[model samples]
Target: MTKSLDAHYRAVVVGGGQAGLSASHYLQKLGIDHVVFEKNTVAHKWKNERWDAFCLVTPNWQCQLPDHAYDGTDPNGFMVKEEILAYVDRFVKKVNAPVFEGTSVTSLEKVGNLFRIQSSAGSVTADSVILATSLYSQPFVPRAGERLPEGITQIHTADYRNPAQLPEGAVIVVGSGQSGCQIAEDLHLAGRKVHMVTGNAPRCARFYRGRDVVDWLADVGQYDITIGHDGMAKKKHDTNHYLTGRDGGRDIDLRKFALEGMALYGRMTGVSNGKMLFQPDLKSNLDGADRVYNGINALIDRHIAEKGIDAPEGSPYVPLWEPEAETTELDLAAEGITSVIWATGFTPDWSYVGLPIFDGTGYPVQHRGVTGVEGVYVLGLPWLWTWGSGRFLSVGKDAHHVVDHLAAHLDRTRRPLKQMANG
Candidate 1:
């Protein structure tokens, strides 16, 4: 039997990651009686989901939490997974956030004028609710994975720890995003044979013109640009380019992988009778990546010229690998490939919320975190307001905006009651 406890607050924030923590910071400043309910410990995903060698693609200075910023000596350095977790932990302590660790919100529904949140520990009612669970909630693997042989081992990027975790054999890493390329590099460096399925994602160097690409983007106001502005919405939905913050920061070009003896193929189409089928568009994929790469460099060059910034002329990026005619299908047994790593990506899951604010695709339909449902808001969704809205550098801004709207909503709704009581 489940026991119900009496609890109430002016606002309830679900999830205890950066988004939730940021929201809590603003709520504290606003003097809103609120509590953050986390499914596990604070920043659980950063602590567990990431691999041992994983580092943030963005630099340390970009880790701007609400009321807290990265003040470390290595501002340009990338933060390792543990470092990120520690930073979040420090922020939680600094703000003295009212977070209930280990508590999971099983369901949320609207009850009369209040939002009723049922959790494993108990229940809480709040005038407003902020769903800051973030976009990366569930690991997404393709349906073709089910067709692989029983002997083969499969792991998603979320569960992958290191090369040693996989079986000793040639490993096929599906998806050529940042995770896929980085994992392939790790496995190759560990002396394991690696085969990667390359996609059409772009690639960019860590630094250009004596400055990190992140710094250039930030200087040019790229991060501040919102989605739905021009063609940004389409760009936001595109697969991220191949890049890594490991070993300092570097580009994860397909050509580089090919030169390193990693067998590269086009996108994984399907699996049939223990054979993995791939499209023979390696050249096209490489070309697409090069286009985006050159485009970014061009933008940087233009920025330098227009601003008259004192920067050296960066060398033009050149592709090194030429495609050789390769077979489209690989016999798993014949090739000695024993494992598959799916670095595909993640999807958002909001089934726990019983609100009608979600779209047909299950994403919460909101305008800058303000849901159509009264007093219900969402945060940390990709492109919620801007390209960087969901990222750590900018989530604080989104949280502040949402909290301001929430406060206004409460004031408008509750002011009448206070006036009547005074009368």
Candidate 2:
């Protein structure tokens, strides 16, 4: 039997990830009556979806939530997946957030002046709704994956737990993003032959001169730079830097991977005659990555020189190009590659929300989290307000902004009701 209950709230948040929790904190601070509906436990993605070896790419100092920032001794260190989950748990307890665990929202529709939210636990009517589900709700594997051989196993990065979960044979890791490079490294280190489809993803050295590259970027306000300005949308959609937080923070350059015995190929185009087809653009991809890598180092160097700060001189990161094995096609069966892991990235799932606020690309049509429709907002989306909006370092800031907008909206909506009651 479907259990049903009726409830009302001033605002309702749809997810319980970092974005949702951050929004809850601000909403509470603003004295707003709200509830967070999470399909699973708090920080569910960190607890359930990520691999065991997963560690935050950003340093601990960047793990700032609403009122809880990292105050530990290892501010420079990275927190593993378990540590991230526990940190969120502690934050939820500290804030005493009104989060309903295991309550999945099935449908969200605007009914007259109120937003009707149907969840597993019950239905909620709210004056405002904040979709904090972040951008990674759905794993995206290209349609070409469906045509792989029946005997080979295929898995997306979201479903990948560890190398042991895979069958014992060579593995082809598609996409040269952070996840793809890291997984390929894991498989290679686990004694499994690994093949990777390299792309034009940027690479950053873990450390440049005297500090982490992330710190340098932060100091220069690189992350604070807003996207969609001067043709940055294409760069924003590019695959993330080929970097890893594993092995105590290090760069995972694809060229190095190639030198280390991992078969490297260009981007996978399609499957033809039971063989995976790839473009002969490996050198171009390597050059693109090198451009970004050297660009950052140059920025750091310029910063040091301009600020008159004493820093050790560092050489520019040169591309490690290999001339051998420049093939554009691979026979899956002939190479003994038994598994294909797609780390192509993710897309947001908002099918349940029957709102016309989304653009043609399925992304929310909003300006800094405020949708065109009144009382509907989205948080933790890339370029919501800035490049860092979706990151942990800036999610709280975005949440606070969204909450302020929501509060003002409520004040406007409730003023007439109060005036009518008083009259």
Candidate 3:
């Protein structure tokens, strides 16, 4: 049963995903009077949004909570959806967090020295606010999709469950990111003909030598590196490298799928009259993805050589197949494409917060989750502090950092900001 929130708290944590729950864990340990306001239930997105076969993209060992790391036997193996949710459930129980599930914070504004949060239940005030809401809350579908004939069914990746759920005909999948390529393969494996549009998203091998590529990279101190380490803060916006944790873990080779009869094209420019128009960059896109796959393997090889590590010898990835000719347009009706899946991606929705902490693009301007505002912090967003800030591998660490800074601020004042505000 959910608990009714009090009129006030020393701190308020928004969002109930790993980020919020992790913050709750730290706050509880320090005996801080705080409440976590979850718009939905705990682990809401993980429970509802993921597909049937969805599993962790990284290894299970990466599932680090505040103190309760994954104790499951298969540290190297990835947990499927059920196991993933169970893990989160256990963490919630372990924390014994004061989480107000199903409460939505509609708006947030600074009232004098205190923070006033307008919520679905009513209003509340707090000395400090921690936003654990991530940026990928809203799924995006292009408006040009409206031009498609009504006969064809269109859905975003979030809505995709299985091939059997779709119409019994060839499916057109746009955007070759992790979701796009994986869903295309899922449909193709189900004997559904897939007409896929490629994007510039890169690919990497799941295992290069003896262990998972992530294991190798972690050994080389890659995940520990902060965002913008290579002068590429933009890398945060780059699509995740195409791979899968399904059936343990493995690489997702789009070229191999192409060789197996999946029709590949470049980006979908628009729908003209009744046909789907595409950009003329299929060849370059495929080549670029392959280049990244091979490059990652090369880096692993260099690491092995430098450390004199006894690992299996490896070589660059060889393309299984290539486009014989560029395909710039697709006739949906002629090709019998009855369904279209837009695996495009998502954007953040932080408009509820009435604060001047956002940039021109509306992204929060924070340093390791600390906003310029004295009593507010943002956590669990991509590139908030590092490459893994929004990922299971690093969200807990990021949460700890946020809570530590917030705890110190409260300690220094030795009184609630609301008390100061009233005076």
Best by lDDT: 3
lDDT of 2 by residue, 186-292 (tens): 88888889998988778888888988999998888788776657776644355677787786799877777777888888989999778999999888888888888
Model 3 lDDT, full chain set:
0.86
lDDT of 3 by residue, 1-423 (tens): 347868988899999988998888888767789988888888888888878888888999998877888999999999998999899888878887788888888999999989999888878999899998888788899888999998889999988888888978899999999988888888988899999999899998898888899999998887888875778577667788899988888999888888889899988899977799999999899999989889888888899999999998798887789788888888889999999999999988797899889988888888889999988999898877777888888888888888888887997766533211110
TM-score of each: 0.93, 0.93, 0.95
Q: CA shift at 38, candidate 1, in angstroms?
A: 1.7
Off by over 4 Å in 1: 1-5, 415-423
Clashing residue pairs in candidate 3, if any? none
**Per-residue lDDT of 197 in model 1:** 90
- Candidate 1 Cα lDDT to native: 0.85
Which window of 10 residues has the lowest lDDT sum in candidate 3? 414-423
Sliding window of 10 residues with minimal summed lDDT for model 1:
414-423
Order of candidate numbers by lDDT, starting with the best: 3, 1, 2
Q: Give per-residue lDDT, candidate 2, residue 138.
A: 83
lDDT of 3 at 77: 95
* Model 3 quality (TM-score): 0.95
Clashing pairs in 1: none
The number of clashing residue pairs in each candidate reads 0, 0, 0
